[model samples]
Target chain A: MTQGMSLIVKTITRLVTSFITLFGIYIVLYGHVSPGGGFAGGVILSAGMILLLLAFGREQTMKIISHSALVIWDSAGALAFLTVAVVGYLAGDFFINFLSTGEPYRLASAGTIPLSNMAIGAKVGAGLFGVFLALAIFRPGRHQEEE
Target chain B: MDPFMLLLLALLAFMIIGSLIAAETEDLLSSVVCVGAIGAGLAIIDLFLGAPDLAITQVVVEILCVAILIRVVLNRKDETHRTHKDTFAVGSVLLFLGVLLVLGGWAMTTLHPFGEPLLAGDQPGVAQQYLTNGLQDTGAANYVMAVLLDYRAYDTLGEATVIFVSIIGAYVILRQRGKLRHDTGNESDS
Candidate 1:
């Protein structure tokens, strides 16, 4: 139901959405060394997508990332996380720390934690955006009810 | 009181006032903006309380919530105007809310004072162990991430599954062209 906004708002959105996405990636990757992890980062990423949906209109955004592709990403993220758990189970425990615990504070140190963060980030971002898209598409009572 | 205490109190008061305004606003778009302000206040309070992760999440959520609510409300039918007022219903609801707030305030008094965490007393709970040895065990600087993904990875997996299912549920509920449409019902056009 959303249409492209005024020139000023669209220009501002184009400039800011990429920065929001970049910060989300930083938060997800450096979650072990800093505060935000997969969940917060993923939500931010979806918020960036929502911004795009608002600024450029829903049809154009859907062209970039289709519904089927998003669903695939959502399932893939969940599967990847479960795969990490099963790997630990192969090492004789449910969720044991099976990998090398490198020096703390380093980017590549947090054994399975960072990997989990990435998987969770992928899933949460995709899933939330997909939900938003579905709801937006089904929105009722707009003046332009053209299918 | 200390400056931090005063600042936190001020932020809480701002959030309370914002919520009241959001609820009372007739225009849905203005109400969404008011709720966004309350969210901004909550994020600042989280920062002051030393929860950077929560603050970041809250700010992003504030943006997303405001965006979505604005989208939903803008160019929509006007549903706020009412033909009649039900004073008794309004009075009972206000009375109920007041009683709940008093009970919540009294319950907050029973909890430990600020900045004093209640560990499992002398024995020191698993949480104490996590804080003490999390870095050595998980090799992560942030213990919160370590706890979420390493010590309790199964829980995260379960949460991911739940999210995936809920997303699917939303799609099923919102899809317009999938199955039979009950055009005969209250729906004018399906």
Candidate 2:
């Protein structure tokens, strides 16, 4: 039962997972200029990871992404976000954009906004994936009766 | 009404129908899917209302919610066992629906029509200020991003903290359960 889906689904998941992750990164990086931002992109990214878990099973997925690593990544993302905000306080205001604002519409224009978005993306993606992993791995007491 | 307005109205009707089905459905899976459909419909309506940022967020949120719900449903029993229907329960539900209809009708009559600005004498509202100066002030072309991360960053930070704390809570609760299971398994083995 833990073996997950058939070979076809696994193969398709392998083929598309990278692209989905890439698209998610694209959304995060271009959040200042695009429709999708950190939260949306992060959810999409975790969805891709979840798709992998569904296709390849929990054991195989955990081998690639250990539980401890997920916790670390999740914390790191939150810390990075807080650090960005704290850095703004150097300029006398909390979360004030202190970095030089380049020309508008450019990728580099949104001083710390893009960085903040990336931090949020990483945090949200890892947090959601961790939640999914916990829920999926949990077996209720009722399931033991069937066995 | 214009074609766009008609389309939006149609979408709203579908959303209402979807919500009704979701509420009344006997099958848990179908009910979850119906709710998801309503969420998607709401995202589309948000898009039509010229809030692409909200639309994007709504769609992604809907996807995440549906995915989590499906995961939960997969583990649980498929059949939804309804409790014995009582006359009191039925009467309360009907009374509540009737009251809701009356209140909704009254609110609609009293409130300003949809698509109109809320503030009567708009002396350049906050939204207008954000639209005009968001790009120049924040150097982010997307006004929503600018507002969320810059103009109203405190609120965003608070939300992020809440999410972080919630995740930690989940981790702690699950960890305790796993440890308890391990201890029990070892004792049985011994």
Candidate 3:
């Protein structure tokens, strides 16, 4: 019964994190219509990552998700966002809309808004995961010799 | 008195109390908490005065500032006041008080908000058009997002760069500073 209970709990945690990540994607995608946008969705995605970190050991998580990759993701996300804004600036007034205003409430709508939200989500999720790894893995007391 | 006047008075009273507490506290942590309270009081004033965005920004910024300051203090040894010189300090305090009085008097007398709303509904004004047309034009739900990402995007990019730089700094500081006995490939030969 105890083993079964543990299995159930593990499954629940995995399911919950998956659900949260999916919801985060939805929030970023539908940010044009909803209260939740890039910033909020990014935080939500980070929360999902935090859950994964909790379920899996630090070593396992680090093996799958490296710090270097997070750094690259953060940089690339920010650069993409800046590039879009610059393109808008060069084409029109400062930070003006350059892309076509597609049919409203559609998947491909909001021109650069959806793309910007995706950038934000990527930056925030990776940045927050980096913070968590720093805080969790680099705890002050434990030494390498202990291993 | 009007509701706004009452709210202003309450906020002012809270500020005075928080300032008194912050001033009396010798413990740096306690003083920081008191300052945080003052920030919250100011945020409440912003909310009551119909500036929700400013209130949210102020709260987040204040929390970040306090957290960063506290973290720095934690990493340092117990600090002692090294200087006893009071001449310049006394003059500076008096100068500050004088400036504070002038600002307070101005605020009390002014009927309108201190600054004009830079962004308003669309009327062909330089800033207003962005706010008015942002949702319709960009399909962004939040006007604040439109402004931050669309209008002031360069500034946002710069801010993100600053965060990345700080992360690198923190990683360096938290890493082993002393020379390792075994030269890892990660380290330079020098």
Tell me, by lDDT, which candidate is best: 2
Superposition error at A112 for model 1 (Å): 0.9
Better of 1 and 2 by TM-score: 2
RMSD of 1: 3.9
Cα displacement (angstroms), candidate 1, residue B79, comes to 2.3
lDDT of 1 by residue, B111-184 (tens): 98887677745678888999888989999998888888988877877878887888889888776654454553
Candidate 2: tens digits of C-alpha lDDT, residues B1-190: 7898899989999999999999997788898999899999999999889999889889888988899899888656657576899999999999999999999998889877777776532687777888888878999998889999989988989999998999999877655233555435445421
**Per-residue lDDT of candidate 2, residues A82-136 (tens digit):** 9999989988789999888799999999788999999999999999898888777
DockQ of each: 0.63, 0.59, 0.31
Cα lDDT computed for each candidate against the true fold: 0.85, 0.86, 0.68
User: Which rank order by lDDT, best down to worst?
Assistant: 2, 1, 3
- Pitting candidate 1 against candidate 2, the one with the higher DockQ is 1
- Which TM-score value belongs to model 2? 0.88
Docking class of 1: medium
Off by over 4 Å in 2: A141-147, B78-81, B119-121, B176-190
Model 3, A30-114: lDDT tens per residue? 7655545665576667667766665665665676787778778877877777777778879976556688757666667667777
Which residue pairs does candidate 1 place in steric collision?
none
Evaluated on the second chain alone, the candidates' TM-scores are: 0.82, 0.81, 0.64
Model 2 chain B: lowest-lDDT 10 consecutive positions: B181-190
Q: Which segments of model 3 are wrong by more than 4 Å?
A: A1-27, A47-64, A86-96, A105-108, A139-147, B8-88, B103-124, B177-190
